[model samples]
Target: MDRISDFILPAVIICIVGYGFIKKAPVFDLFLEGAKEGLCTSVQILPALVALMTAVGMIKASGALDSFTYALRPVAALLHLPQEVLPLALLRPISGSGALVIFQDILRQYGPDSLIGRIASVMQGSTETTFYTIAVYYGATKVQKTRHTLPAALTADLVGFLMSALAVRLLLP
Candidate 1:
């Protein structure tokens, strides 16, 4: 398996280059063009990434996140979910890196073998940064007026969070 994994990428590249040669395509030039386009796309998205990172930093520094988490503690308790995972659930849809920091903090606080840790792990796998994705992808494509997308993505994130809790409770020891 290890050998196959090592060989797979080179094999695929070889096949692609071979096919390009057969088709009389300028593989090197095409590769360079693609790389240049990717670099340009990265440059375009840098501002969005910086803005998100700054917002996340400001939110963390302002103690707003803690207040919000405290406010949600009652509802979380009622739902039989860990209060610790609340921030992760809320942030996961807004910023992937921000959610990751929360997720890592959870794992650090409660060892990965703990119930809360397992739930956090599952939640990370199950949920996604819906808003961040929309911002980046739609921003890149210059698509405005994201009507219904926000609601739908957020709904899915909520469901994923609930299912993550249910799954950990039912499946874990």
Candidate 2:
């Protein structure tokens, strides 16, 4: 399996180049053009990405995240979520790396076999960094009026968080 996987990418690349040659396509020029466009897209989104990262850093540094997690404890309890995982849930939508740090802390504090660890692991897989995604993709595309995107993405994140806890509970012995 490992040997086959190692050749998979090379095989695909070889097939693509072969097909391009057979079709008389400028494969190298096309590749360069695609790379240039990707670079332009990265440049276009850089401001939004920087702004989002700065905002996340500020929120974390100001202790606002912890305060918000504390405020959400009652709601979490009502939903039968472990209070320890509240920070991970709250941070998951804003910053993937930040949520990852919180997730790691959860695993370290509770161990991977524990309920909190399981739920956190599930959430890490299920949810997304909504704000970061919106910032990059919308910024790259120059989308001005994101009328329903934010709310819809947030709703999905909430479902992911809740479902992560519920699924773990159901599957546990």
Candidate 3:
């Protein structure tokens, strides 16, 4: 099933290309042009990608992420959450890819039965990538700056993490 997903989109694209070629459709030129546009897109996105990575690196290098995890420990205890999830809570808000990586690590460690495993899965499912959102929003628009950008994004991610856990508890046993 998983491999099917890996193959599906490429398979479809190949089919489309083959059909276009057989039918003598104008798709070859269009495809080449599309490929050029995609290269342009990759170039355009490099700045945002670099910026997001740098920000994530700085956050991790500073003690803030550790402090945030430490702060979450008490709440985790009160909620009977597995201690492992404390670091996840901190990661979930700031970096989406990092959180997903950590989520997979928790899943591997606890085999999905552990409280942290289930919660990490839920958090990974529910949360959006904050920097990705900001980048896309800013990239598409002409806005130079926005007020409360960091605070709003962090708040959304925080609320999403809480709700993911709460929803799992209420809905999933």
lDDT of each: 0.87, 0.91, 0.78
Residue 137: error of model 1 in Å? 0.7
Q: How accurate is candidate 1 locally (lDDT)?
A: 0.87
In model 3, pairs of residues that clash are none
Identify the leading candidate in terms of lDDT.
2
List model 3 lDDT by residue over 46-125, tens digit each: 77778877988788788787787777788877765667877777776667777778788889989886666788888778
Model 2 agreement with the true structure over 1-173: per-residue lDDT tens digits? 99999999999999998999899999999999999999888899999999989988898799998899889989999999999998898889988888888889989999998988899999999888999999988988767999999999999999999999999989884
The total number of steric clashes, by the backbone 3 Å criterion, in model 1 comes to 0
Put the candidates in TM-score order, highest first: 2, 1, 3
How many clashes in candidate 3?
0
User: Which runs in model 3 stand beyond 4 Å of their true positions?
Assistant: 15-24, 74-83, 140-142, 146-156
- Count of clashing pairs, candidate 2: 0
Clash counts for the predictions, in order: 0, 0, 0
**TM-score for each model:** 0.81, 0.88, 0.74
Model 2: CA > 4 A from native: 1-24
Worst 10 residues of 2 by lDDT: 134-143
Candidate with better TM-score, 1 vs 3? 1
